[model samples]
Target: MLPALVERYDYDPYGATYIAYRVPSTYDDASQTRDPNLLTDPAAWQPCESSRFGNPLLWTAQRYDPAVRLYHFLFRTYSPTLGRWMQRDPAGYVDGVSLYTYVASSPTCHVDPLGLTYIISPYQIEALIAELRRRPDIGGGLRGRTRTPSDQKAPTNGCSSPFGDAPSGVNFRGACDEHDRCYQTLGKSRFECDNEFYADMAHLCLAYASSEWQLAECLRWAMVYYIAVRVFGGWADLYDFLKWNGHARRNVSPLEPSRPAPRSQPPYTQPPYTGLGAGTPWCPSRRSPYGD
Candidate 1:
């Protein structure tokens, strides 16, 4: 069997499932459309241009970064086994459900993680899901391609900083003046963002996290919390929200009872918070009323 990404349905009458990346094909970032009728009405799906990198599709028309481009490409290129086509059903909608038909091999419905069984070695289904999330492409030929950081040779100094603070870390020295600031200080590689260019890195990270089948939804919430903390005075605000006391014991074991039990005559009884008997031995005469 070809090494592929698979999704199975346990309850379907037909032993139907999906296998992605079964064939090696390049995906064209352009020429995709988001027509809804194609999903609701299979007849609406016509031939579209075949991608040299991915399974080719019949050419319906040309488009650039359409919302449903990924779905259109997958369904149009998918070649099911003989005598069977991907069935259209409400349950089949996983991620791209709004734009394509759902297929199943059995009738039993199951959830992610706990539902998926018998995965082969060295497989990560969540990462694959993350890559499938659609992001709006405002420009062309610069999204997924790779390059080194110093490719653009943008000026090391100027107005390219994201925060635009003169005290900011963008000053690389000896490259440009304040009017020609370098773009590397904006949280991207020096090569990726040179000349004030942005790559939608944040959206891409969010999409990757959202698509993972194994990652819980709470992770997304935690990310939101993390962002909020950074925006509003960072760790100080986070600590305040946590109600952390300055003197909270560090490295203490909760499993092993605390140093002083509540009934055992408080830790220190010195004058005005001076009860801590430093370098003094407890007098035997001062026995507890409750005995040892």
Candidate 2:
């Protein structure tokens, strides 16, 4: 019997396939091997040239035409060669920009995991908040240009108002106060609101709650409130909105979940992957197409 070959892939933080290695099954300690030929061979490994969805484990492209290959990114069909979508975004102009733009035209920094939704990982969120907090401009002037220490003074009554300026803490009142303050100061402008305050509110909500998922749901509702107030210039009762959309649950989480089985097998699940040349697998086995 022929010795089985084991292939391992290494990816960058952005899920880009940077290096790959193939080793014989007989090698008990492959990591200790110091073979220069094995390390330097060009044929042994290939870097992913495509911008978005570089990790082959998660992304599977279909060859509809003999000459061209297209990937179904859930939102639209993407042509790798053209580096654009074959179809316009299904969400229309919700991004308030070009529907054809990919990863908000920033592939290096951002990734659209589901193709339909743009998500920043919890680690990324934490890092971003830390960086933002470090900045003198944002941290020093969190209460807005006009507001001073006196203006941020706590309400006279013992009960905390959502708009009150208080340091974020484990208490829900503190979290809500911080979120409202973020909305007032940073969320007034759409650019600052989405980029800075929204994430800050998410962090604050998560910080106060014991259940991360439940707090995530609250964050979603908070976003809806911000959108209604700032974008549409309308009022929405938070209680009414939450009650109406009670069925809505948290889908995104900070920690990774176990890989679920694919709903359906792809057409190219089997071997004899004729068109795809050497190095690439016929289809990923055991490993998930979603990122680890």
Candidate 3:
């Protein structure tokens, strides 16, 4: 049997209010009908029972209690309407003087997924990289070029690419070796190789992380390694292909119209997340079509 879709909710800038799905139907007052899913005017809408489709979960995958209008977080209850926690932070006041303030009132910059303490949001992944760059040991990994050590179809021994070898507080040698084997295998597609590599590294991080901080830190390094291979891995393939065909491009005559090399595009940034966004909107729109 096919699964039924529950009510879809559109959260406001503050994650306070929700606009439910509006089913379309003909209204007597107008030739056509369009009344915000028809729930606003039940008498005008098709069926009165349609209102029951709403889901209990709201912003950030947190359960919302309509009775108290509070978000049930892992460590504390939060009032998105007030942009404050329902109780003092369990960790006490380390971020600021107020224990109830979310992300030191900088929700746009940070997120507290566990309701324990704030961490830099994905929006600041670039900023996080910059911050990490200051640490010599960690930053050194971020600056190098990458290449497979040998053509030996050995996953275990050839897994350490220059970039992957850098210390990121995470042990990815097993996964990296598997990735190398994938790329080195005959007839193995580059896309498949890269994806398998990413999944391998990510799985290692997931299995290794014991805490939220550890998970985030490990994933950050995973992303760096993944990004490195994706950007430059294509060049490796091209070079290998040319060498196998006995026409190394570097030694080719420059007088000829050198063909433009195919560019490797990193996966497109994800679309603006419109579903269940719970973060405090830094730039609240002056006008909302839903009449917020």
Candidate 4:
């Protein structure tokens, strides 16, 4: 995920945004042909402004909080299918999210209720790999330019080139064809991903929202579970637990450990959280989308 950067201009009065999956080469070129105008140009080969978020030409402010930017970038680009599913079935996802938040904020954190453990089975790992192979849209490109979800593969270890002659052992276990079918068949549906693995994923997300404990532990747990699930077989017990409990797992409060998440921070942000650095006031530009 790209960190948001502010660019200045002397000629053209207004500047633009640049949202890219991969940083452009110009940014690294010795000659530095990385002109903001060219990079953000609507006519550029990699038209970034076309994303669901407003056009770079017209949009003037980053919509996300600075701290959450990394969170959004990772989750958004890495788990588009999961993100979409969350949007489609928010009630279901919210149940898990809420439980995670409660655990994070609770005092006397003796045991991390949200810190889930799992042992990935080989079958699950193969299934995940198959899903990757199925996604040509994310993988098919020249040499080593392809990108996959952070959880799916690592580029440095050489998993980027899905079609290379000397394919890396880090290569996706399954093919893109299978990934497509699996994704399509399960789009926004309550299908089980390795259930044993989810306790860990849920914890990581909750960690992102908290500052109370050792989030690093949560991250480590997430990675371990991810590798296990993607490299080994899937976990059937976790899947059964999620299913048996139904799609929504209600969180119980101190008094009622069964009640739904006690309306924590409301789903929506109260005010737009434009990330202007502290001490410096945010002076909205008249022409900017976030007008004063």
Please give the CA lDDT of all the candidate structures: 0.24, 0.37, 0.48, 0.26
User: Against the hidden true structure, what lDDT does model 1 obtain?
Assistant: 0.24
Per-residue C-alpha lDDT of model 1 across residues 9-90, encoded as one tens digit per residue: 1211222222222122432212244443323332322233233334322221211122222222212322222212223322
Quick one: ranking by TM-score, best first? 2, 3, 4, 1
TM-score of 1: 0.17
Tens digit per residue, CA lDDT, model 4, 1-292: 4443323222111112334433443343222554555445433234233344433222212132322221121112111112211122212232234322311121121111122321223343334334333542222221232222222322222112213211111112222222222223322211122221232232223323233232333333344334333322233433444345432244321111111212452232112111111110111111111110
TM-score, per-candidate, Cα-based: 0.17, 0.42, 0.38, 0.18
- Looking at model 2, report the run of 10 residues with the lowest lDDT sum: 272-281
Better of 1 and 2 by lDDT: 2
- Kindly list the per-residue Cα lDDT of model 3 for residues 9-99, writing each as its tens digit: 5565456756444344533333244333433454443332213555666677777777778888766888977998888876554444677
Q: Model 3: number of clashes?
A: 2
Best by TM-score: 2
How would you order the candidates by lDDT, starting with the best? Answer: 3, 2, 4, 1
Candidate with the greatest lDDT versus the true structure = 3
- What is the lDDT, from 0 to 100, of the residue 260 in candidate 4? 23
Model 1: lowest-lDDT 10 consecutive positions: 273-282
- In model 1, the runs with Cα more than 4 Å from the true position are 1-133, 136-202, 210-222, 244-292
